[model samples]
Target: MALSTQYADEDSQNVLIAKLDNAKNVSNILKAIHFKESATVFASSMGLKVTVEDSKCVQANAFIQEGIFHEYAVQEDQVTFKINLTVLLECLTIFGSTSAPGVTTNLKMCYGGYGCPLQLVLEEDGVLTECSIKTLEPDEILDFNFCSENVINKIIMKSECLKEAFSELDMSSDILQFLMSPDPPYFRLSTFGDAGSTHSDFPKDSDMIESFSCTQTQTNRYKVSLLKPSVKALGLSTRVSIRTDNRGFLSIQYMIKNEDGQICFVEYYCAPDEDVSDPYS
Candidate 1:
């Protein structure tokens, strides 16, 4: 499948997006219930990116369906990120916020592809963990409140050292504010820690590399060809509008027409230049 690039915000030449949950909500209308993971993964404009506190703080896996970047936070220093598990949420800009400003809104956010990147590393012994959306604050501190000891213990067991050191937190915390990060729970960083464990079900790959963090846009015209990555299983081809300013770097512009509808839109993005071949003359 050809790859398109996903940007962070919407502009004249940016990609488009669609909120996954909203689609399912409207799919059944009266049901108004959220769809399961895959539906959201495949259809989200701006995916509902979240962090998980795994007990095996040793590793994490990326969500194959949504194509988001989910993995361990392996820093260049070779030290694994440790966190205090509490409220784990991704700090992303809601692209088309003009519709429903403060609610738990949904839209189709444009993006590059599934396979994202890794965000952490273990120092000293230099170990790496993989799962979904891995990374944390080295100096972060957290506390569990209004919860049961069993819940805390369960979280602890599940998070392993993550709760103790990986401190799962939001993107705005003082600790997270300065840290680099990843979005999708499953992404393509290095093929090593990515294959994960046989005890787990994350897709395996032996050839992958880390790159710049990508972005998303809001649109309704994207087509899904593969659902094998990120919590957002969305796969956008090199369709839609794109142009480069004479430079080798490529830029894509996604135009979304809502017609008479206020929510529907056009989304698009540019994929890695190296990933795609020259267009047919």
Candidate 2:
């Protein structure tokens, strides 16, 4: 179902509308953050932001900017709602998750404000599928307060290199340690588990190291389980930015390029494992 070209019509209806040429672009991004059942969505003229969280300790966000959509509009300042991510994803890929040689799924999404179900109209090769998913009370998202100004260490690198490190991580380990210093062993990841201790390091001058900055030698341990989900984002990204604040909280941002060559971003914020005592403390 193609949306009306006139913004006045969309605004007068007091509804939010957005249309995308390809549904897979949205499906893929949501899949990366689909570890949870429910997601809180915020829609504005800027774009759509979908957030998933676990125990308020770990949070993941998928951002699909307005630039990626053929038409996007928000009637108010913002529209907020919660949805069953699993059901929404299924509806988005009803036509099929994979793309055929020349077939494309076009999607028209709409929301009629609070207490209204999210409506989706998907058409592919002249075939159409319509879905209306019930929306629930939006959960209160956690405020990480992880500002760049508070970041004590930061590393920018090619995702390919980190992808290898994450893939080979010792699953037996309950915690993964990140070591960043201004000296040798510039960056290191270590895991201690039933088998043994394993460490992977990246040199500051290595080609894979796009940029590295560390105010001081600092090491922090994070729950491996909390970080494992981030691999999904790492796999889809071309480059990644890793940062840790003075409190030792970890932030990993992935730069993903969509099928249309538009840049989208997915990020994960994880609280440091409290069981692992801070050596510096």
Candidate 3:
């Protein structure tokens, strides 16, 4: 049977259908959270969410809203599936990843009921490519519940400031410590390594800090290896928001702007390393 015909019925019976004018928009965002090979995808009327995790200690989510898609439809309250992100990314950019003059790739993605492979159709410069990636059984995802009400300290800053800090981070460091307070040392990031320790501090009133609301002094430590993946998002982002909750949980949000000047968000959540006691506790 032809590929189109094989999926024609499935398409009509599909629980989710999404289309993108430019595949690069979705490809670029997926790259930000590509640390893991497999990712859980959730589809709803609100949008699509792709989640990746490492060692159950760190989690990253990439959100692509329905508004970003040229056509979006969802027949169910929620549709969940797991797929190899590496494969999906490759299929999304099969035509060509890099930009060329007057060239763009269009994408149509469809998912039938359970146990069906994800169907993808790509077109670029008059060329069409089709891909079917097998979907795996869904896995239980972690819930961090790091809500705003639980946030103790939050800071919004330009990505440029954090980019430098992340780039120069000492890999030798086992843990990255964060200290936020309303008093002196309003915002601080420290890494202790064989060469000793390095600290990067941002003044609350600095131009780089757009907003600072720190009610109490809080200090927490997280595995350096886990948070390193966020650098991908930081590099491509224009703004970043840092928040620490009362439980010492950390959340970092990156605001990325696509080629079309549309804004998308990537976020990371990390559990504190309990081996190190919280100074505020």
Candidate 4:
């Protein structure tokens, strides 16, 4: 590709792979679709600034020491961010005008020539609580500095709800909550033993992606077998995602429950490639 022709960041492609890998569950097929879309959206949002491999993503942890487990001194959960959304919004406003690639636009900016990639900040009691930016959106400084922490927590409501499902092996109870939402993409997830998928009104044959039980081979290691992989590619038809083949890398955290009935978490560290694509998706 020519330099003047412009290219999207290589990391965007990787994130797409990550999304596809996470998209395996039969319940929240849309989340995989959403993850895949984030890459395209990131590309289109950055426009000329976002060239092939221009951007890098970091999943920094909010660490706490062995002696810092006290209630008042608990390590504040933080996902450190260093972002460049200016060029990003420009690309997104052009391509993401429709929701095909999971473009999230502000209602206010929609009429005002579409804003930029937004930085949604939530600060309460002198602590920086949350900073969420729409993956592909116009440049909009939606600085919602909330006075209360409750409102900011709502942003990650899905992560919490999904934890409920992940904590238990059976998903029958959790599946009953949000399957029939009249929304375009209702995202949900399952871990290890469950299957998931997405549904779209436009696609007549759209259905749920099935998941299955997986056994842990070792700490933080798992394997599941399937004939056809559940997710998409890292680049445009260049590579595919696999379960054991690729080391999973997540921008977010994975919720897990232990045998002791307590909540635990895992972050995607890495993945192999499409050749190792696992049916677990």
Tell me the number of clashing residue pairs for each predicted model. 91, 0, 0, 40
Model 2 Cα lDDT, one tens digit per residue, 7-59: 34654565688889899899999999999999999998889999999988899
Candidate 1 structure quality by residue, lDDT tens digits, 4-109: 2222222223222222423222222111111112112222323222222212111111221232212111112222232222211121221222434323323233
Q: Which pairs of residues clash in candidate 2, taking residues 3 or more apart in a chain or in different chains?
A: none
Misplaced by over 4 Å in model 4 are 1-62, 65-155, 168-183, 190-248, 253-268, 272-281
Report residue 87 deviation for candidate 2 (angstroms).
0.4
lDDT of each: 0.21, 0.89, 0.90, 0.23
Candidate 4 local lDDT, 172-212, one digit each (tens): 32221111122333233323333553322111123321221
What candidate 3 gets wrong by more than 4 Å, as runs, is: 1-10, 277-281
Estimate TM-scores for all models.
0.17, 0.94, 0.94, 0.19
Candidate 3 similarity to native, TM-score? 0.94
Off by over 4 Å in 1: 1-240, 257-260, 263-267, 271-281
Task: Encode model 3's per-residue lDDT on 1-281: one tens digit a residue.
Answer: 99779767667898999988899999999999999999999999999999999888999999998889989999999999999999999998787656587678989999986999999999987788989999999899999988889999999999999988876777568889999999988998888877877888889999999999999999899998898889899999999999999999999999999878888999999999988653422
